[model samples]
Target: MAAQGDNRPIGVFDSGIGGLTVARSIATSLPHESIYYVGDTKRCPYGVRSESEVRSFVLQAGRWLAAHDIKIMIIACNTATAAGLKIAQQMLPVPVIGVIAPGARAAINSTRTRKVGVLATPLTVRTGAYTRAIRDLDAGVSVYGCPAPSFVEIVENELATGAHLQERWLQDGDVFDTPENREEVARTLGPILEPGIGIDTVVLGCTHFPLLVNPIRHALGEGVRVVSSAEETTRELTDILVRREQLAEDDVVPEHRFATTSDNIAEFAAAGSFIFGQPLKSIEHISLDELDRY
Candidate 1:
């Protein structure tokens, strides 16, 4: 809750640049508030890590945000949210929100056939996090899970627009992040997505998956609806903030700050601009070594 003299910005962090998707949604949805976003680029993919490691990584980011005096914290990464939302919320004094619940709720609400599909990282699938969340929300709903480690590669390589996504994502045998492998990756994942006889709604369970939503939608066709956590998470945050009186009242032009654990300014700027749909500013680099000490 925004206490006395508490106009501090909301702090958001993810395992990597993909959480920019969530930051962008909040920036547009709640334009008056300031947001501080951090991407753990050095540990780009947290989905495959152990639960303890994920908890530690998430708390490190959370504690940093708390020290910065943020009134609210957003675990923008789905994997992080799946791994650490409950503990982080209990540990933190302020309101902490994540993407999974909202997205799961939205998926349950949107599926007319009660059959839902989830495309996520190997960690998300292995954790069975999304499946459990959706089932807990509505036992009537069925969730199908797909692990997508390749999606990260496509984003990392900045090759989503071309055929390269196919080779890197589906085939599962390549060390290269190039256009030449896209077809293989696409074909590898295509069989599951090709006109599924069961699922009517598909969930993009990873932050990186949203970057591939267009092609994914194409592959699944109009019958299988797609759900992403971005907009839903923003909406959920807004509701919670309003209830808690943490939402800003005025329509002030908002300022956004972006940071990363790695010193890759160009990659940060590129992905951030695409998500924010504007020229991103205030990009900073802070390593885990320094962050861990605090």
Candidate 2:
């Protein structure tokens, strides 16, 4: 029989399709491991929800993932991580990994000037998770947090409409490379990229924010290092698996499954394929109404 630990899949979840970024990274980094991904698309934009509400939603989803016999769980959304990780670590049977600490660690390691900036949803900013994580590593470093809620909408199929974007930023087009587009993005993000902030590294605090890295990096200028938790978090996952001797032993193709709390599984699958550059297998629809029983 196969090693017991290696046979179990890794459970990863986000408020919506954004966590696919994390899933994609995990697949790329560990080709032999199976993944069970859950995206709470029906009640997405978890950024606006109260912490208690988000925590409840997260727990419901966690219980659902646990039923699949996953060996490890990754909380891929910053808002969910802020609201639910502690509770998850306390209650879940498997090791719970979150995006904030990895992202903060990557930023602190990449910064040349001890100055770091974080762009996240307003809810994440309110939690101060990134700020606290960074300071926990190095108390002398300066951390700045900016709420970039619009970026989340832009990534999850909401088109950014403005004369400059002309529906391109939300469309499948590159807007970050062109000078005019960059200028427009800079102008649009002016308030967030405030003056006199000499940060050398920026943490993309929300999982969805990675989709807007180009524009965000351009808006912040060339000098700032843009950091996404996907890669760093994947590295953390790899280390954990190795330390636990849970790494899969073969390169055989692993079964990956997708689940969403949304009624529109077709739309969610389309968006997931677009984000991951691969056709998603049959997506299972999960209902929050039914999940409330657990």
Candidate 3:
């Protein structure tokens, strides 16, 4: 165990369960570290919100997490990261990491061709964070970022089983797994992947986008590589912890805590189980009104 950060839980937050992708990666990569996750499912889809509003929500969540004595803060939402990361670094006492830089690095490393395509939320696309990050790594890389506003809604709706684990997997098919869903996704992506783009790599720039990876891969074809921020972000988090001597040394299985700013916490718990691939036995409910106090 590192002398300084051996016992504190790491904090992670997203607008909703989509960030579970990152959470799953962290659990797999750094099994010894504990995690406290906050999902603001009630006021979610922060992608459509104004930058100032997104920043405020992120800070509210960060404050709540920090109050619990977390060792570090991970903003797992791409929209929130785009809107609030720099401010979060200044505001929070612990290290604050976001999804864009790691995803950008993954894309930059995976692309054999210099062209990379980004599919993300409207706000994230507007921020151009991924483009800037990729360019920062290698100035000559071509980035084509497209706003896929409906993807988040699709994922949320698909994850909505209304508290029943058995019902979560739709009979027709999971959100993007059906032929109809795949066609719709392909139609949505057509303009983004138009002829002559020649992008050899595509970054799933929004955390929610990973849920639709199958359809996205089908739409973009097998030739292009699809990169999600989860894996690389976990890698970055692990590297930071190790470099700072913050890695937990004990063999004890880490305890995970889940919280949500949602009225229907049962649904959120179901969604967590559905998206996170973990049996979420319980979840604490938090209200936006409470977050407003921070």
Best-matching candidate per TM-score:
3
Of 1 and 3, the candidate ahead on lDDT is 3
User: How much is the lDDT of residue 5 in candidate 3?
Assistant: 46
User: Residue-wise lDDT of candidate 2 within 1-294, one digit each (tens)?
Assistant: 324347689999899988989999999889899889999888989998899998998888888788778999999999999999999888877889999999988998999989888888889999998989999999999988877766676666532222334345457576434565456557655764676767888888888877677777778888888999999999999988888889876766788999988787767776687666577886898887877976
**What lDDT tens digits, residue by residue, belong to model 3 across residues 32-55?**
888899999998899999999999
Residue 222 shift from truth in candidate 1, angstroms? 2.7
Model 2 CA lDDT for position 22: 94
What is the TM-score of candidate 2? 0.89
- Give candidate 1's whole-model lDDT: 0.77
* lDDT values for all models: 0.77, 0.82, 0.87
Provide the RMSD of all predictions against the true structure, rounded to 1 decimal: 5.6, 4.1, 1.9
Stretches of candidate 1 off by over 4 Å are: 1-6, 159-197
Instruction: Tell me which residue pairs clash in candidate 2.
Output: none
lDDT tens digits, residue span 1-294, model 1 = 452223568899888878888888888888788898888988877877888888888888888888878889999888898888888998977789888888898899889989888888777777788888899999878777777776776666663233343344456533342344445446645646655447888888887777666567656766778889989999988877776777764755567788888676765676567656676678888887877875
